[model samples]
Target: MTVAATEPRVVAARRRVPRGSARRHIIAAATELFARRGYEATSVQEIVAAAEVTKGALYHWFGSKSELLTSIYRELLAEQTARLRDIAEGPGPVQERLRAAALDVVAHTADHVDELTVWARSAHLLDDEQAEATRRERRAYHDLFRDLVREGQDAGVVRTDVSATVITHMFLSALGNTHTWFRPDGPLTFAEVGEQLVALFVGGLRP
Candidate 1:
């Protein structure tokens, strides 16, 4: 029996999803599993099962467990980079812009705590190549915060004596680490916590 022309076209189209998309699906599945079960506990076989793909497919996309983790890390870093870029480019007073950016970070972390947990847990387990790649991506993200601090200083909106590096570290440490304590159903909204943090940094407790 001969197949219809449209049937052949549909079959061809089904076989032609972008290579990058397939890899992303694998990474996303692995990320969820790794978050629920730590790196030492999760197996590649289990990851493939959760992803609903063959072991061969997973292997074809990411050569090793470390590589898969690296891919997820890069994906997260890309997301943060894009968000920070938008906040940095937006018009507002420096203080307002910084507050908005901090709030957005907290909100994002709260929403994706699972992914962040996976990233934090597996970051140190990466191979040397993956480690270096993660470091570079992290630095790019960090630079955005650093620039915000510089802008605050230049505008005389924040303390000039405080190093931009220190400020940036403190800001991220507070925002990113919220995943450890934040509950989606908690009494305090992410925005409230973010505002408190911004206030602490911008206007210290001293009378």
Candidate 2:
């Protein structure tokens, strides 16, 4: 039997493009502009010009500016969620798995500083429903990481004094805030920064 090929990515009512380049270009342009110019300050016209696509084309892939912004974050969140799920559920010593999960999330955030910065700065502007949806998705990722911590706690590798909930949020808060001060050209490379952050996280979990 022949296997079926995966369907292509389509956004905004499935408008077709020249091999999906239109969607790719719009997302890329919007991410850069939203990161550089505040999302509110970045106009659709500017995005169109930067993307070299028409306003209609932009709208074809995104229903509204908010939708575009959400897409940027949702995609990144989806990618992170996949990685987190793998690390959380994959077989290993609970302590090692917990450490790996913390390191992975921080590293992922550091890698996507620009796009994540755009979302962090502009997510408040999203409409209530969209904002809630994003939060739900983000919360799911948080819960996945927390589950690993809970596993370690149950196994006595992690301290029972701190709630797994608090521990998870504490590490995640730092990981999410890396964009505020981290600089690629700074004395410490992002990898070094992530290492230090992970060390602090794992240290706190010690029994």
Candidate 3:
């Protein structure tokens, strides 16, 4: 009789975890998995095992595997957007702010190299809706940086010969592809590399 009465409650209890340790563990595990194994190859079973959570926990928190992928990047993008927004609005000369802004982006990307590497490798595998959503988030970041460049131009510090749009793309392109060849033990320290990249950007902006 007791077993029969307990059966219903057991069935009712799903693996619903609140926004707590399990969710964070799953995200970190997934990020590492995707970075190391490639998103397409990583399986939900593997994620569950790595995260040490049940399948129900993953489903309870995230809608699907694609959502996990999007969340990883969206989380990073959100923090980056906040950083760029602060630097852009901070008190300073526009040219100095612009340089600082570009440096901030490169610095953050460098620090989260694995996440960036995951993004570079797995972005193409995302569906159209997922891809477009990520693009919009990225576009917002791009717009903020570009606006800073335009502000510099208006202030007569940045060059007028080149459009702000082109300058924005150029620096980002270099930074985005850094994962392809950059090495830690190379002759240039990462700091030196970042400084040189910023130099290339700021020098190009001179009127």
Instruction: In angstroms, give how far residue 124 of model 3 lies from its true place.
Output: 1.0
Candidate 2 lowest-lDDT run of ten:
11-20
Clashing pairs in 3: none
What are the TM-scores, per candidate, against the unseen true structure?
0.79, 0.88, 0.87
* Candidate 3 residue-wise lDDT at 171: 94
Q: Which candidate should be chosen as best, given TM-score against the real structure?
A: 2
Better of 1 and 3 by TM-score: 3
* TM-score of candidate 1 relative to the true fold: 0.79
| Candidate 1 Cα misplacement greater than 4 A, ranges | 1-24, 180-195, 204-207
- For residues 33-147, write the lDDT of model 1, one tens digit per residue: 8877787789998887676677778889788888887777677778988998999889988888887777777777666667877777677777788788788888988998789
Q: Write the per-residue lDDT of candidate 2 for residues 67-161, one digit (tens) a residue.
A: 99999899999999999898888998999988888788778877877888889888888889999999999999888888888889899899999
Ordered by TM-score, highest first, the candidates read 2, 3, 1
Model 3 residue-pair collision total: 0
Record all residue pairs in model 1 with backbone atoms less than 3 Å apart, i.e. clashing. none
Note the clash tally of each candidate. 0, 0, 0
Estimate, for each residue in 160-196, the C-alpha lDDT of model 3 and write its tens digit.
9999889999998888887788888899866568778
